[model samples]
Target: MTGVNIGILSIQGDVAENVSATRMAMDELGIEGVVSEVKNPEQISDLDGLVIPGGESTVIGTLSLVSGSLKKIKEKIASGMPVLGTCAGMILLSKKAKDRVVGEMEQPLLDHLDVKIERNAFGRQKDSFEADLSLEKIGISKFRGVFIRAPSVIDIGKDVEVLSRFNEKIVAIKQGNVIGTSFHPELTADLAVHKYFVTLVQKKN
Candidate 1:
């Protein structure tokens, strides 16, 4: 894992937290790597893996698009750059997104991940809550998932693997090396999910 470069899309959302979590995960795994904030296309191209943190999907997408980072991210992911998309980041990674209340959303998206997402599937910010999740795919069974205005995967491609669910709704999913979660694993104390993603980066690069 030496010299592996992992970047957190830092246009918005949990930039600092994701950076810290990824660094801690790398340390915990004894993997030598660089984790930093990435906002432009040049920085994105340098990443072996990426973390799109939880935040307003539209805002993040728009900001990235302004600097042409959106297209670069899609290209990287398409080229097998492992990415971890949490909460709104998950929605942005999907092929399509429909807001439960507003129906369709006209927002910029990476649209490389093969899934249809329902925005705000868990209600609004007021409905935010935390729960114990069983994420056996990532090796931790008793993971505490933090959800905040989370989106769910209502439809997925055949190759997509369901990692976890909440109230029978799809919450966490993995399509190849790309992982999308409706909850915020970076917001939790446990670093299992981040560690798992780091290992994937290690293997890929």
Candidate 2:
């Protein structure tokens, strides 16, 4: 498909990295598109797909909520606009989130992805690590995962499919057009996941 427009939630996190990866993914897939950093509801309404990059979940969610972008995103996702949420982005997309260190706390969340996420499931910032992950659902037999203060899926609805795992922990999951990852795909060089998302957007568009 041509003129596929994608956006990265730029309220917080790796906006530049996500933008670059998305552009690369679109180019690699030979899909003509514009990848922009969007933080307002108006900018979000035009997106074919969106990437909620890894960042501070609380801050991102709160800012989006205050700016009315969160509601707009939920509406788009409900309308079948493909969304890829990485790390903190995954937390915001979840129906429930509890930080392992502090348990559950009030936070604005999109609550569109039907899963309960355990924030900082691997420990704290110092515990961040990378590993080789096999995301067979995305046709990736082997992929490098960059986990930094990542969140893991502890509970999922019937529609949710576990895509990848590490140390017996759920790191990646998908429910229809919504994809969530506990690792940062943009931080890595692999384009498999991003390219797959681009194709998903193209298919939906």
| lDDT: worst 10-residue window of model 1 | 134-143
Candidate 1 vs. true structure, TM-score: 0.97
| Candidate 2 C-alpha lDDT tens digits along 1-205 | 4589999999988999999999999898899878999999999999999999988999999999999999999999999999999999899999999989899968999988889999999998899999999999779999999999888999889999999999879999999999999999999989899999999999999
lDDT of 1 by residue, 81-110 (tens): 999999988988889999999999889998
Those runs of model 2 whose alpha carbons end farther than 4 Å from true positions after fitting are none
Q: What's the lDDT for residue 101 in model 2?
A: 84
Off by over 4 Å in 1: none
Instruction: Give the number of colliding residue pairs in candidate 1.
Output: 0
